[model samples]
Target: MSNLLAKLISMKYKGKSNIKEYIMEISNLASKMKTLKLELGEDLLMHLVLISLPAHFRQFKVSYNTQKDKWSLYELISHCVQEEERLWRDISESTHLSSTSQNKKRKKTKGAAEGSFQQKKPKKDEEFTCCFCKKSGHMKKECPKYATWRVKKGLLVEPTAK
Candidate 1:
């Protein structure tokens, strides 16, 4: 009898099952205690049900406490089911919103990187600067002055074009 009472008090809802099943399980335990000559009041049973719920039901518990009227076992089940649905909806919506924003940010960053790379690439008709002469229109390797200096220094053999 003491064991049954202790079990009833220590029962916790871990969300492994639906709210209705959890509440009914607790109710069954309370009924068993009653059969063993340990009578618990209806109000106490309601409070016990509330206490067994997890922290996710904190707002629901607070609302129940602040209300002027009390709820029966049936009303408690109904309200709890409604609150559970609302919580699930809120969770799904937030997850979707966050994922959508993340995808958009990735696309924007990818587009910006591609645009910057394209801007840095030189066009076919664009002029180049010669590092050897500090002039435009050709690169250092193709500079006329650099070729003459290389020929004078015997660093290059002049190609005879026919």
Candidate 2:
């Protein structure tokens, strides 16, 4: 009997199991204690259930404490189940948002890398011709010979040390 009472007192809801199941398990222990002539009040059992919940239920616990109306065992179970669903929904939404943002970032980086490669490869149909040197495979602005001619002609400024 003492062992049962100690077990009931020490029981904790670690969130590994379903909230309903955990609550029922605690109620079952309380029932067993009642059969042993160690009856625990409904209010006391409610407090025990709240105390057993994990840290994530801190807000729920606080809300329950601050409210004037008290909850029965069944009401407590219902509210806890709702709170658990809310918590799970919040977590899933945040996970989805993070993954979506990460995917967008990856696509942007991939597009930039592919764009750089595309820019480096010239189109087959467009043959570059240097207007100044009359040379194929090169443009006038990119022609080394044209640049030297411009430097000699004083059209292009030679870089000077600041």
Q: Per-residue lDDT for 32-106 in model 2, tens only? A: 999999899999999999998889999999999999999999999999999999999999999999999999999
- Estimate every model's Cα lDDT from 0 to 1: 0.88, 0.91
Cα deviation of 153, candidate 1, in Å: 62
Cα lDDT of model 1 by residue, 28-85, tens digit: 8888998988888889999999998889889999999999999988899999889988
Error of 2 at 136 (Å): 16
Give the distance in Å from residue 29's predicted Cα in candidate 1 to where it truly belongs: 0.3
lDDT of 1: 0.88
Which one is best on lDDT?
2
- In terms of lDDT, model 2 sits at 0.91
Give all TM-scores, in the order shown: 0.67, 0.66
Task: Give residue 97's error in model 2 in angstroms.
Answer: 1.0
